[model samples]
Target: MISRFSNVNRAYVNTVGISSVFNIGDSMQITPSIKVLAIQREQEIYYDEEGKFSQFPIFEEEIPQPVFYEQLTTNFFNKNPKINVDSISVTSISSSAILQIGSTKDIVCESRTKHIRQSKN
Candidate 1:
């Protein structure tokens, strides 16, 4: 049963030199899901009259870089010699299904919408 939808919340810049945040936990699935809750732009933050700001949609600017799950594994391992990641899952950007991430794979998503509304660069 899906509860809430939340996009992968982006955090600070990592060693790979990209901005990132923790994606919705693999185990969590809420129907009315909140895939991501990103902050709007600088000027819009001050003048958006629609109260859309209340929603606080995720902003592309806030997310400068998005390193894939595989990348994370390599980067994480390199930084902490003591830590060892084994498995990882990759998400399909075009899918609606929530992403499943492991220690050494990529995150994957089973998309709901057929036409990927998200802007792909």
Candidate 2:
């Protein structure tokens, strides 16, 4: 299957990979996982109290002690009379950073839901 792990951008580092696939009835369950490692060249953007923004240097190879992990799961079904996305589940994992200088952790931000319709009447 085509996945994020296979088509990662060259500008950032990631450890996401597919862990397993299990067939249950007519639906298939997919498990996509991630492990934390520092993002290369991805800046930590910050906004101060006075409404000024600043860029902080995240040193090279500094593994992120991420405070939040977000995942988006999409269910797609074709326009057949009997098929539709029934449900989805997402999970994330993380570990403690050993060489980072700040107590501050990373925020993985995203909006979590979307919907599309395919119907035959």
Candidate 3:
């Protein structure tokens, strides 16, 4: 396979992320699994405020079950074969993205994110 890249300004990959893939000459197989639990708290205060801010509490029962178990037991990819690519050209690949130019047998990617946000004003 022939891959040509002209310019790549920036790439931001986070957590379980794949930024870019220029080229895969031969066959490629990838299996990636990720589970993330993120909690964020925000509080806004004014200049004329007087009293103190209350505490933020997180109870044990508020949490939920994990996300990896159910996904692990499932097979979501196709069982059919794929044709190979002859040539490819990419100008930019940014921000948790993927660019592949080749043949792939089985590619399974699983990502679960549980985000909890609390804001007080």
Candidate 4:
């Protein structure tokens, strides 16, 4: 197997990310798991000559359960036995991503994001 990478000036990997990989790489196994919950609340109040009123309610939500990595990995390998790649070339990889040059037994990446926005006036 031969891998040649050229003219790679700059690469940025953020949060849960993978960088660059050079030649003659073998058996690259990477497992990245991430869970994110983002909540935003906005409230606006208006006042007149008579009076002013503003009301905002509380927000409540339950978080989801985590993923089973062992089962996922087993299922992946069982489904795909022979995943062969002679050569690979890439410019960049970011945000729970993978950059593989050669052979690998297993590669599993999982990400879950939940966003909630509440506005009151």
Candidate 5:
């Protein structure tokens, strides 16, 4: 699981990379169900009292990201009738640092109204 922070110091989940599956002891194999979250930032366009259009930072609520699950192998389950399911091992890999977005232009605002409506609910 990798975490990223916005300019306002909001910590959000950026990515989840599963390199391998969890092994139930050295006998049985299992599947993985991963959940991820991400945030999309944008600018809100509105007219001021003076009738001049302006933009302001508006960040949408965190939403679920994509997760890829690998299929479990049936060979291991078939071989081991009495599976040793007491212990489990998780594989870990070196993760790279989080990259930050540069400026307000990077944030999209085309769907600002739609996001705002959703957030209220």
Candidate 6:
């Protein structure tokens, strides 16, 4: 139950609090159910003088839309059949921005998928 919502540099979280470690280009599940969002992706194709295309694959990687609470609720429901995150939002808290691990924060293990939860309200 730490307040995830703040005016500056603080994020609003729904079920879970700020991730112990956040990073750019990292996929974080702010809640138990939210999944990755697919947004408009762009790529530049190389061309020859005669408009011939190159054989190399296009490079595309964008920082996804700043995670949203509504999207998180929807994903949470789809992932969990028993508990709905929507109900939790109605009662508990909703976050605005996700806490991303920056260069200033301490970095833990790189390749670990850890899930930490709060036991009390």
Best by lDDT: 4
18-53, model 3: which lDDT tens digit per residue? 333443433456555444445576755333442222
Measured by TM-score, how close is model 2 to the native structure? 0.16
Each model's lDDT comes to 0.32, 0.28, 0.44, 0.45, 0.29, 0.28
Candidate 1 structure quality by residue, lDDT tens digits, 1-121:
2223233334332222112223433343322222333335434344355434234434222434556766333223233323223443443322133322312234332212112133325
Clashing residue pairs, backbone N/CA/C < 3 A, model 5: none
Runs in model 2 lying further than 4 Å from the true structure: 1-104
Instruction: Give the root-mean-square deviation of each candidate in angstroms.
Output: 16.1, 20.9, 11.3, 11.6, 18.4, 20.4
Alpha-carbon error at 41 in model 6, in Å?
Answer: 41
Q: Count the backbone clashes (under 3 Å) in each candidate.
A: 39, 0, 0, 0, 0, 6
Off by over 4 Å in 6: 1-10, 17-98, 101-105, 110-121
lDDT of 2 by residue, 1-121 (tens): 1111112122221332233222222222222333322223234543344221122222223455557578868775434323223343334212311111112123232211122233444
Query: What residue runs in model 3 are displaced by over 4 Å at the alpha carbon?
Result: 1-23, 43-97
Query: TM-score for all predictions?
Result: 0.18, 0.16, 0.38, 0.39, 0.17, 0.16
Consecutive 10-residue window with the lowest summed lDDT within model 1: 109-118
Candidate 6: TM-score? 0.16
lDDT digits (tens) for residues 19-112 of candidate 6: 2232233242433222222222244433344222232122122324545667333222233222112211112222222334322222222111
| Angstrom error at residue 107, model 6 | 1.2
- Output the better candidate (1/2) by lDDT: 1
lDDT of 1 at 88: 39
